[model samples]
Target: MINGPNFVKGFRVTKVKEFSLTKPKPRTIPVPQKIPTQKPHQPVPESTYRSPKEQEVLQGKKLTNRQKAEELLIEANMEQFKCANPEKSEKTKRVLSEIMREEDNKMAFNKVKVQHAPMKVDNVPVRLNAAAILRERALYQRQVEEELSRIEKLVDGARDPSEFLEWQRQMHARDLEKQLADIECRRLEGKLSREEALLARQNLIQENKKKALIKKEETEKLMRVYAEKRLQEEKEMRDLVEQVSEGHKNTKQARMKLQKYKQQIVQEVAEESRELLRQALEEAQEELRKKFELIREIRAMESVPFIRQTLVDLTQTAGHGLNCEMSIVELRERLALLKEAERKAEEEKRDQILEEKQLKQQHLLDTLEQISLHRAAQAKAAVLRLEEKKSKSQLGKAAIANNDRVTELQRKLEEKMTERKRQAEALKLNAQRSTSKSCKNSYEEKHWKELEESRERQAQLLQYGVVSGETANRMAAYQAARNGTSQAYVMPS
Candidate 1:
C-alpha cells in the first residue's frame, strides 16, 4: 500500500542496513597475560608451569604464523580446562552444559513480545468483492499501459508511439552524411584553391628568383669590370709614382755632385791664394837682407882713418894680397841700386795676387747660380707630384661609393627573398588550419549522433524506476562491455 517513492526510499534504507550487517569486522591478535612468578625463596612445582615458547612470547619475542596458531590452540584448551583425566573432563563438560542450559532459559524468560499500533481496517470483517477487485485491477492495468506508452514516446522522441526508433536513427544518419558531404566539398574546394594559389605563388617566386639572379649577374659583371679598371688605374699610379721617385733621386744626386764640385773649386782657390801670399812674403824678406848687407859694408869703409892708411900700406908691402876698401860714395850708389830692384819685384808680385783674387770671385759666383737653378727645378717637381696625388684620391673615393651601392643592392635583394618566403609559409599555415577545421567539424557531428543515441537509451531505462535508473543503466553498460558489445552512455535522469 506504500507509494512508489516511499517504497524506494525504504528499500535503499534496507540495503544500507544489510550492507552494514554483512561488513567484516577488523581482525585482532590476542596476547596472553603475563604469568606471575613466585618468590626465589619458595619452591615451585613443575605441574603449575609455563611452556618455553609461552615464556618467550611473554618476554616479547616474535613468532611465526604456525607458532602463533599453536599457541592459540594451547590457550583454547587451557581456557576449557581440559586435563589428562577423562572423568574430570566429562564432569567439567556436564557442568558447562548445565550452566549454558540455565542461561538459555533465563534469556528466553527475559525476552518479551513487542506490541505495535493496529491499522484502521484490522478489526473490520473480511468480505469477498469480485467486481470491485476486477475494476481495481483494470484500473491498474490501464495505468500501466499509459505509463508504457509515455515511456515509449519519451524514448523515441516522436509523436507516434508506433514508430520505431530506427527511422529516427536513419534520419540522423542521413543528416550526418549530408553534413559530411558538405564539409568534404568545402574542404576539397579549399584544397583546390590553395593548390592553385600555391602554384601561382611558385611561379611568381620563380620569376622573381630569375630576375634576382639576372640582376646579381649584372652587378657581378659590373663589379668585375670596375675592379679591372681600378687595378689598371692603380698600376698606372704606381708606375707614375716610381718614375717621380726616380726623377727625385736623380735630382738629389745631381745636387750633391754640384755641391761637391763647388767645394773642390773653393778649396783649390783658397790654396792657390795662400801659396801666392807666402811667395810674396819670402821675396820681400830676401830684398830686406840685401839692403842690410850693403849698409854694413858702407859703414866699415867710412870707419878707416888716415893714420890707419900707413899701417894698411905697411901690411900690403909685406906681401899680403889684400885690396884697398871702396870709398863711401860708391857704397851709397850700390845700396841705391839694390833698393830699386826690390821695389820693382814687389810691384810685380802685387799685380799677380790681384788677378788671382778676381778669378776666385768669378768661380764662386758661377757655383751659386747653378745651385739656384737646381732648387727651382726641385720645387716644380714637388708641385706636379701633389697634383697627381689629389687625382688618385678622387678615383679612390669614386670606387668606394660604387662598392657601397652594390652592398646596399645585395641587402635589399636578401630582404625581399626573406619576405617572400615568410608569405609562402603563412599561406601553407592557413591551408592547414582550414583542413583541421573540417576534420574537427566531422568529428563533432559523429560525437553528437552518439550522444543522441545514448540519451534515447537512457530514456528507455526510465521505465525501470527512478531510484535505480542510473544504476541499472550502468549495469547494462558493464554487461554489454563484458560481452564485447558496444556500450552507450547513461544520461542522468
Candidate 2:
C-alpha cells in the first residue's frame, strides 16, 4: 500500500477493503421459517369496478382489476355466439379466441413481473415481506431439501454400483499420475546449467517489475474515485438536515398563527352573545315598568266617583225594596226566605238520594230473585231429565215383558181353538135335539156372546202392547161397539 503525502492536512491514508466485482456464491443453508398459527386480523382490499360478465357469474365474489379486465374481454368474445350461429361464426370465434389468448398471456406476464423498490435519497432499501414471506420461504426450503435429498440418493446409489465405481476410479487414477509426476520434478530440483539459471532470473525480474507498476496506478485511480463519492454524499446529507430544520420552523409559525386566530374568534363570539343577552334584559325590564305604570294609573282613577258608579247596576235583592242591606228587619226577612228555600232544596236532594238508593236496592233484589229462579229452573230441569231416563227404562222393561206375554197368549189361543171346536160339536148336537126355531135363536144368541168376549180380549191386548192404540182405529171400534157388532179389518200378512 502507498501512503498519502504529508502536505495535505487531515487527509491520512486509509487501507480500503478489497471488494471483488464478481457476484458472491448463493448460501446453501436455508434459514428456518416460522409457521403462523393464527389467521391474519387485517381486512382484505376489494376492487371498486367489475365487468358485467363477472357480475352475472360471480354472484357475490370479489374480483381484482386484472380479473375484471380479463372477464370483460371474454364477455365481448362470447357475444358473437348469441348474434350468429356457432357453425357459421366459427372463423369469428377463432379470431376472438386468439385475441383473448393474447390478452391472457399479457396479463399473466404482468402478474409475474418483478417489481423493484423505489430508490431513497441515500439508497434503495430492501423491503421485508409480512407473514406471507415466511410461508413462501418454507416452501422454497422444502423444494431445496427435496432436490438435495434426490441428488444425495443418486450419488449414494451410483457409489455402490460396480460399473459406476469403475468409471470414478479411472478418472482418479489419471489425477494421481499427474501428482506423481509433480513429485518427481520437485525431487530432481537444485541442479541447473549456469546459463539456464541466469536466464530464468532475468525473466522473473522483468515480470515482477511490470506487475508492481500496473498495481500502483490502479490503486491510485480507485482511491481518487472513492474520496470524491464520499464527499458528495456528505454534502447531500448536510443539505437534507438543514431542510428538515427549516420545515420545523415554518410549522411552528403556522401553529402560532392558527392559535392566535382561534382566540380572536372565540372572544368575538363571546362579546356578541353578551350584547344580545343585555338587549333582551333591557327590553324585559322596560315592558315590566310599563305594566306597573298602567296598574298605578288604574288604581288612581278607581277613587273618582264616575269611575266607581255605573248605570247598569246588577246588584238586586229578593225583596220588593231596592236596597239589600237597608236595615236588619229587611236583611232578616231575606235571610229567612233564603233559609226556607235552602231547607226545601235540602229536602229535595235527600228525597232524590233516597229514591236512587231505593232503585238500587230494588234492582239488586230483582237480580237476586232472577238468579234464584234460574238456579231453581236448572235443578228442576236436572230432576226432570233423571225422571225421563227412569221412565224410559221402565217402559223398555214393560215392552219386553208384554212381548213375552203376547207369545204365551198366542200359544194358549191355539189350544183354545181345538177345545172350542169340540164344544161347538156338542152345541150342534144339543141344537139338533131341540126344535128348529129354538136352535136358530140359540145359535144367534151364542154368536153375539162370543163377539163381545172377543172385543174385550182385543181391548186388553191393546193395553198389553199386543195391539197399537190409534185414534182412527179406536173411532171405528167405538162405532162398532155402539152398533153392538164387531168390525173386522184385513191385516197385512
Candidate 3:
C-alpha cells in the first residue's frame, strides 16, 4: 500500500510539472527604457497649470496629465518636430509615452513610505500604578482644597495673598496641586497640554502681579516720607532766613551805635587838643609878661647909677678965691638949682599924669551926661503915654503915685548931678594946678636958654676976630650978661 501511495504521489508531481510546462505563458509587456526629459528653464505660468483647488483634488498626480495640452506641446517642441517629420510623429509620440511611463515608474519607486514613529508617551517621573497615583491625587486634592480655603479667606478679608503670614504654606500647597495636575493630565488621554501650561503661566503671572503691587505700595510710602521730610526742611530753611534777618538788623543797629560812639570819641579828643593849645598859649603870654617886667627893672637901675656919676663930676670941677668963692657959691647954688630942677622935673611929670587923668574923667562925665539926658527923654515919653491911657479917676491916683516915684528918681538924679559937678570942679582945679606948676618949674626953659647963650657967645667971638686973652674976657662978659638977664626973668614967688 505504501508503494502504491508513493507511486501515486510521484505521478501527481510529474503531472503538475507537465501541465506547468505545457500551459502557454502570458505575454509580458516590455518595460520601456528611461530617457531623461529636459526640465523647462522657466516655471509654467499659473494659467497653464492646475488651479490650487484642482491641485488639491489631483494631489500626487502626474505633471504631464495636469499641464495644458498646449503647454505640453510647447515644452516638448513637438510642433516643430511634427512639421519637419510627419511620418515619425506617431513613433515619437509612442516613444514619449513610453519615456513618461518609465519616469512615472521611477518617481513611484523613489517615493518613501514614511510610517510615523509610533506616537510616544513622555516618561514622567511619576509611578503609573493606579493606587499610588490615586493616593497622590487625593493628597494633592487635599492640598488644593487647603490652598483654596486660604485664598478664599484672604479674598473675603480683602487681604493680599502675598502679604499673608502663612504665604509660604499657601505656596507649598499650590506647588503640590500644580504637580499633581501636571502628572494627572499627562496620564490622561486627549488632555490639552496647552491648557495645563496656560494655567501654570497664569499662576506665575499672578505671583508677579502680587510682587509688583508690593513694590508700588513701597514706592508710594517712600514718596510720602520724602514729601514730609522736604516740608520739614523747607520750614527749617524759612526759620533760618528769619533768624538771619533779625541778626542782620541787630548787626546794623550795633554798627550804627558803634559809629556814633566813634564820632563822639573823635569830638572829645579834638576838644581836648584845643583846650591844651589854649592853655599853652596862656602860659606863653604869662612868661612874656614876666620877661618884660624884668627888662623894665633893669632899665631903672641903670638910669639911677648914671645920674649919680654925672652929679659927682659936676661938683668936683669948680675952685676957691672970691671968684673961686663965687664959683664955689655958684657951684653950691648950681647944686641947689640942680636939686630944684630935679624936683621941678618930677612935678612936671606928676602934672602931666594929673592932666591926662582929668581929661579922661571929663570924657567920662560927658558920656554920663548924654546917657542921663537920653534916659530922661524916655521917661517923659513913657509918662505921657501912661497919662493918655488913664481914666480921670485913675489918672488922679496915678498922678500922686507918679509924683512920689518921680520925686525919688529926681532925688537920685540930683545926687548924680551933684557928684558929677564935684568931680568936674576937682578935675578943673587939678588941670589949673598942673599947668601953673609946669610953668613955674622952668628947668627945661633954663636948659634951652643956656644952650642958646652958648651959641650966641661963640658967634660974637667969631665976629670980633679976637686973640685968646680977648676972647676969654669977651666970654666972661657975655656970661655975666646972660646970668643977669636970666635972674631978671626969674619968677617972684
Instruction: Assess candidate 3 and give its lDDT.
Output: 0.64
In model 1, which runs have C-alpha deviations exceeding 4 angstroms? 1-167, 225-493
Which lDDT values do the candidates have, in the order given? 0.67, 0.66, 0.64
Name the runs in model 2 displaced over 4 angstroms. Answer: 1-254, 302-381, 387-493
**TM-score to true structure, per model:** 0.15, 0.16, 0.16
Between prediction 1 and prediction 2, the one with superior lDDT is: 1
Model 2 C-alpha lDDT per residue in residues 211-250, reported as the tens digit of each score: 9889999999999999999999999999999999888876
Over the stretch 1-493, how does candidate 3's per-residue lDDT look in tens digits? 6556453233433344344677788999999989999986997688766567766644443433445545867887754432122245567899999999999898996798887443333454655454554454456557669889988888788567555747885566556555544443343311233334434565576588689989999999999999999999999999999999887766877899999999999999999999999999999999999999999999998877443344434434345434445444457887998999999999999999999989866765555555456557669999987876464435344444444443554455455446545655665686698789888778668866785676566656556754354555556566657566432231111
Better of 1 and 2 by TM-score: 2
RMSD of each: 75.3, 75.4, 89.5
What is the TM-score ranking, best to worst?
3, 2, 1
Candidate 3 displacement at residue 103 in angstroms: 99
